[model samples]
Every structure is written in C-alpha cells, then in structure tokens.
Target: MAQGSSSPGDDAGNLDKTFREWQDDGSSEVATLGGVYGGANGVNHMVLNVRDMEKSHDFWTRVMRLEHCGTQGGPGQPRFLRFYRSHGHTHHDIALSPAKDPDSLPIPTGPLQTPGLNHFAWTYPDLETWKQQVRHVVDTGYPIQFRMEHGMSQSLYVRDPDGTVVEMMYEFPEERWNENIEAALEYRRVLDIDNDPDYFDPKPEDMPLFDENGLAEAS
Candidate 1:
C-alpha cells in the first residue's frame, strides 16, 4: 500500500529544501554527510549492554520468543549472548553483553521524552498485521511509545526491559518511498545542512512523535 505523506509540520519540507540546496552547490560533502555511499541497507542488528547475560538471555528467549544464537567467550572473554527471532537471519537481530553493573548504564527512568537512540525498527510485510501486533502489545500491558505515519513507513515503537526502544514498521510501497526519497533530496538541496533532519535530531517530537509508552503515534 502507499505509505501516507508526513504530517504538515513534519520535517519533510525542511529535508526537501536542504537536499535541493546541496545539489546546487556541486559539493561532494552531502554524499559523505548523508552516508549515501553506504547505500540503504536495513538494520543489521543492535548490540546492548545488560547487567546479567544469563538473566537477559532468559528474558529474551522465554518472554520475547527470540532464539538464543549462542554466547561469546567460554569462561573469561566477556560474556555476550546473541538472540534472533526464530524466523530471522543475519546472525542475530539483537545482542546482549553483560554490564558490570546495571546502574552504570543510564536507563530511562523518566518519560519517553528524554533523548538518545529512540528505537531500532524492524520492518513488517503489511500495515494491518502491524496494527494487530500493536494491539496485542497494548492488550498484553506492554508500553506503547507511539505510532507514526512516516511518509515512507508506518511504524510502532515500544521499549524493551532495559528501556532500549524498539520499533516495528512497514515500508511504503516502492513508488511512494521513491517519491519521498526525491522529496528528501529536494529538502537537502534547499537546506545547507549536511544530512536530513529525519535521520538525525534526537528529539521525540521532531517528525515522529511517540505516545506515553514511547510508541510512535500515527500522524
């Protein structure tokens, strides 16, 4: 299905302006700034630090239904465990390393409004099932951060046990995504910034705002 356009106040306008300005300058900086050379590969996986490897592993495996990919280091190497969705490939979708102390890492003890690595998103096949998954998580009493209509994707955000944010999304159809890509390029041209705001900006209400549970609310 066609992904919806971003809301009026969304950063798409700014991005299109920025992209246009960059192209006019004939500067190679935009490519480097945007990491365009790396191409658009979906997320490989995310690595997280946890207080206890065994406890984290058990929670992921039993509660989240992820398969244990195995651990690194037999005895002293720094115990790290990998886990993947039973149906996922790529070694793992998430990895956990034991933290010396949980308190050492800053967990979100406040509202979702606080910044930093809002969430990592996984793509789904369609929007209907995606919404169902959101409903399921809500019914199960899991916090929903927000739901968002990204103009390129429809997404849902939630938090994991350690306050790591997670997202599930369905990319817009190719044609629609391409249109947004073109618009984003235009935005980049008009604005002199090195990269698009959609990709950077640590604020939650930027283009994508999340609900109380931290889910990206649908625009």
Candidate 2:
C-alpha cells in the first residue's frame, strides 16, 4: 500500500512504526512507571535561620561579599535579610531569618568525619579566583576550618557568624567526578588525626585583615 503504512496482514509492520514514534517522543513512559522524581535541575535558593538578623546580614554582605537585596521587618517583629551573588538575577540565593536562641544549635566542635550536612559548596570559574577568596578569608580572620582536595573538587571550608559551614570549591573535569567522589568518601572513612594530620587549624596567622574582596578592613 503506502510506504511504511500497514496492510491488512502487516501487524508486525504497524508495531514497528508505533515503536519508532514512541522512541521519537524523547521521554520514556516505561522508565517513569516507577514514580521516581528526577534530580534537581539546579539550585533555586536556600534559607537559613540566625539569631541576630543584622549581624548575619552584615556577615553575608560585607564578609562573604554577597549582594544585599534588602531587609524586611516591622516594629517588634523578626527581621529577614535577602542576599544573592552579584551574577544572580533570581530572587535570592540565600535568606536569613532571626531565631529566638541562636546559640542552641551545637557548633561542630571536631573534624568532619561523620555523616551530616558537611557544607554547601559553591563553584568558582578558576583557581585564581579561588585563591583571591582564600586571601580574603585569611585577611578577614574568618575561622577557616580546612583546605582540602576532594578528587572531584578542591575546597575551602569556613563557618559563618551563625555557625553554618560554607564551602567554596572548584570542580574538576567531568570525567574525573565519580572517581573523585569515591576518593573523598574513602578519605573521610579512613581519616585519622595521628595518621593524615589536620591541614586547617584556625590560627592568628590564618586570619585575614580584609574581607573576601580584600577591600573592607576587618574590625
């Protein structure tokens, strides 16, 4: 009959045509049958609770060098501070809210060897930019915990005013990621104080006199 069309006895031909059309649609109906939601497409934003809204805002904007969106609050009410990276156009990357008792959250006293939120990592374009941030952290006297090679990424960890750990990282090439992640996990598992030794112990020399941009003089 017509090219690629089904005839009365051509059931196999019709099935092949139907299967091809399904494949062309790009989404797999059969694969989605398990009801699994896909991974996140990207990071939208994150919110954090802090004790002093003003202090937290200053730390993020002045020290961390994030762009301050604004502050919102009324008399006798808790305040909220919104911030985003200079390159970000969305609402905000982070929001800080005032909590009643800030000190209640237990600060991580020892090295990060256990399972939990280790830190939130942000990527940098290159090593130079990362080192500039390192210099800023050193100058500002921010409590830097460690500088580490995670195989997939090189990272620096620091604690914010509210005791939240933040990470700055430069991701390695895509092909190396899986091996790096595996290596990082193994490193964490086998880490020992006497064996590997700690690289980042906060000291007076490690503290920076300026903020991240190396502009503002720390007080």
Q: Which candidate number would show the highest lDDT if scored against the true structure?
A: 2
How much RMSD separates candidate 1 from the native structure? 14.1
Q: What is the TM-score of each candidate against the true structure?
A: 0.56, 0.60
Q: What lDDT score is found at residue 41 in candidate 1? A: 52
Cα lDDT computed for each candidate against the true fold: 0.55, 0.57
lDDT of 2 by residue, 7-100 (tens): 5355444555545555676655532111222212467778787777777777777667888775567425756455556455656778777666
Candidate 1 per-residue C-alpha lDDT over 12-129 given as tens digits, one digit per residue, 9 for 90 to 100 = 3445555565677776654321333222355677778776667667656654556777666653466645555645555677777767667777677556676567667777666565
Off by over 4 Å in 1: 1-36, 39-42, 52-64, 74-77, 86-88, 109-116, 182-219
TM-score of candidate 2 on Cα atoms, chains taken together: 0.60
What local lDDT does model 2 show for residue 42?
62
